[model samples]
Target: MQNRITEQPSNYRDLEKKTIEELTKLINTEDKSVAPAVEKVLPRINALIEVIVAKITNGGRLFYVGAGSSGRLSVLDVIELPTTYGVAPDLFQVILAGGVDRLVEAREEMEDDKNEAWEKLEANGISKKDIVVGISASGTTPFVLAALARCRKENIDTGCIVSNPDSPIAAQAVYPVEVITGPEFITGSTRMKCATAHKMIFDMISTTTMVRLGRIIDNQMVNVKLINHKITDRATKMLMRLGNINDYDTAKELLFQNGSVQNALKSLNPDNYPA
Candidate 1:
């Protein structure tokens, strides 16, 4: 069997050396290349964001599916959405090959199974109104490809972020973003450049989608939830600055009364609302 992952590596010539400085320099240069590779796929990422924003604006949720490191990344992105954008927990979802347990620990023979991924997605009641984005580095991960294929069959909108060109996972997705990072410093260690590129792509996708959905105002994170002490303090300051209310106590009282700065501002004045 051909190892699709081991077959690609553009930096093997440099890893053969024993010098520490050589390895450090080679890794730094390779890491620097990740952003440019991601930049090449901006147009594609933007399109996916547009679709995601439209769906979310229409009361639809977004889901991320992947396996191994890719799966973990998806989980991270979903977990952060609630705290960052004040979106409901269900607004963003994630699935892994071995389930949530695989997040902290690895599972054996999990990614190899094609049927398990769709089963998990189906259990969550994925439908046409929702958006699914599969993340894979090799672009041939059975788990990721299977999830995308099932989504296609169900007439659901699907997209993929992969690190290989003409990848099966990409071809299966309606909006495929291929970031060709070439290879790893340690040969097949995709957790290096591949993971970084995947994160870059997801950051662009999620942030842009949030912006389009009006979670952001100007460059500010206007939708963040003030659910904790730190967030409450930050939200109070932001409201004070935005509403021209310099009194800290008044700002804190307003935020506590309304539970959200946007709502508080809107309730304070009908015409001066951010909406």
Candidate 2:
């Protein structure tokens, strides 16, 4: 393979000879650079997020298409939206090249399946109302590239998050975010820094979209799912604090009765909430 920055040798050589502490510090230094790399692409990221928000608010959906580590990370990001922001499960979808069932199996060969992502998106009934964002560290994953190409040909809005510049995936994307994370500390282990950048960007996109979509009230996740004791307890506390319910048990009771922090708060005065 041709030399990309990701394929270059590590700056600190003889890694097997280094102590655990030395290795950790070296990796830490490299990891610190990831945030700045992402910062440089904030403008591009902002543009892509604007498009996503527009599409989703109009009853459209968002789809993340990728393979390998990128695909798995995208899957993780989308799965959290329903619980975290109370959006519909289908609002943020993911198309993993090998399917989510094989996500952890290290099925790297699936990245070479250029036709799979388009098929997956088509199966999902992707339309111009939906926006598909491709994720790839090298910006050359055939799975992602082909999907974006198909989306463009069909006039669907398309975007991409990649770690390299002037890559094929970016060329196919209408709004391409290229966060140059430089070389990986382990020289090709994109699961480290590249994944971090993608995670941060995903956080930005999903959180901002949710907040704009009215899932958040103030800084709290008022619409968050109360699926477990931990979250139930947290929501109860929020209800007590926001609704001025001095009694803890009463606040907890209200939470169970209403089912969500937003609902609990609105119950205090129906006039305060929209019809």
Candidate 3:
């Protein structure tokens, strides 16, 4: 068992007596502490990401599993990969303790069902070709722990994002990331600082992985989806800038014809296009 840093008592006292301004300032102060915590674990995060990139590049997929707030955050992370980076939707998947179909509802009791995650992964045909990341701020979610243990038994790659050190879930993770976010301002409410840490790392992983996979060009989201007028307009402008076209209509026409920023650019520069 580990010292559950996320479950520690709040450093502040008499919260109910504080003014709203004081409360906000205190919470903001605590929130500021989150980045330093995540900063200390960047090396571990980098190592895990390297493995993820290698596996995913070789046809492997990424899977995130967790419960409650962690589960919801995991859902948010992978769901946007397609629209944000133009990655294939099939490349990222999330298995929430509460069914993804029930994402709008808080089915906390489902977290106790230790077998559900494993069953879901099995049904998804999870194999050694996939990398499973368990997200549990307390580092003790039964759903995530059970799934990671089973993945290990089956020789599948396993990693974890946890806020506590030496936790059971972390023990099961071959590549464990312990961000040690101390304690939430609301005691055991991990949706605060812990959530912030996990969210930041999720962004890092997706962005870096997409870049390594050739989805990004320079510092731009050259693979973004133009699903709406705003994005279509933005992509048109980006194409004009990146492709060095003088006419907006020409850039917009090429962008619409090719579907995405990357493809649009490729159409204009076939000689320098990737495979």
Candidate 4:
């Protein structure tokens, strides 16, 4: 509704009669711009990560609020935090515009109601002990902005990830993240570039925050929950490599005994020294 396509020519229209190779070239070109845009916001992002780490360390929670494509992506990011970094599921939550059913399906009409966002947060018992990161593309999503405003009124720390600088959402948040991913290839269809930018920003935030919370060691996800065979396999290998064990059996045994790669390494090696 912001008429974002009018401001950027590259987002005006799609190729009408282009070859597959040509279309791919254009898309790849647009994709390349996303990271650089995110790069500009790294300093702000680092600060927000530090803040989130402090809150989490103090037994607080992290909330992601958004609508439509942004909301679905935020949910995906938080859903993986537990298995990927060993964070508590209850500590990380997603508040979509119309709720869980809308995430998988469509609920475009729900994006207009500002009060619904606050209701969602209230249902979760949001407090000042929590950190909220709102995601929106045009930075004008009433749902996300209103949720952030309510959080601010309640004295909760708030941040945002948006594609436009000086957006209304950014203006309302204390720590605003402006990725400036430009316009979409489909002219205001933010599910394209904006969605990718929000995902990248969410990844950076979660990964960096977990690192600060000691969930990682030397680029290894040491706190990853072994919730499945794939994770179990990864944990076994990590334990084997870190403990200098010779066989899979020894690694698996230690992993089972200690229940974690970090603990297994401690049992096997004691310290990073030749035994």
Indicate which candidate wins on TM-score: 3
User: What lDDT, from 0 to 1, does candidate 2 have?
Assistant: 0.87
Where's the lowest-lDDT run of ten residues in candidate 3? 266-275
lDDT of 2 by residue, 1-275 (tens): 23356666668789999999999999999999999998888999999989999998898999999876767888888898899877799999998888887877878888899898888888888999999999998889999999999899999989999887788889999999988888888878899888998999999999988887778887998888999988988899988888889999999999889878888888887876521
Q: Which segments of model 2 are wrong by more than 4 Å? A: 1-3, 270-275
> Candidate 1 on 102-138: residue-level lDDT in tens?
5777663588889987887788888899988888777
Per-model TM-score on C-alpha atoms: 0.92, 0.95, 0.97, 0.90
Clashing pairs in 1: none
Question: Quick one: RMSD of model 2?
Answer: 1.8
Global lDDT for candidate 4? 0.81
Measured by lDDT, the strongest candidate is 3
Which tens-of-lDDT digit does each residue in 18-109 have in candidate 3?
Answer: 99999999999999988998899999999999999999988999899988786798788888989988878879899999898898897989
Please say which candidate is ahead in lDDT: 3 or 4. 3
Q: Can you tell me which runs of candidate 4 are displaced by over 4 Å?
A: 1-14, 267-275
TM-score of 3: 0.97
Model 4, position 244: C-alpha lDDT score: 75
Displacement of the residue 87 alpha carbon in candidate 4, Å: 1.8
- Which residue runs does candidate 3 get wrong by more than 4 Å? none
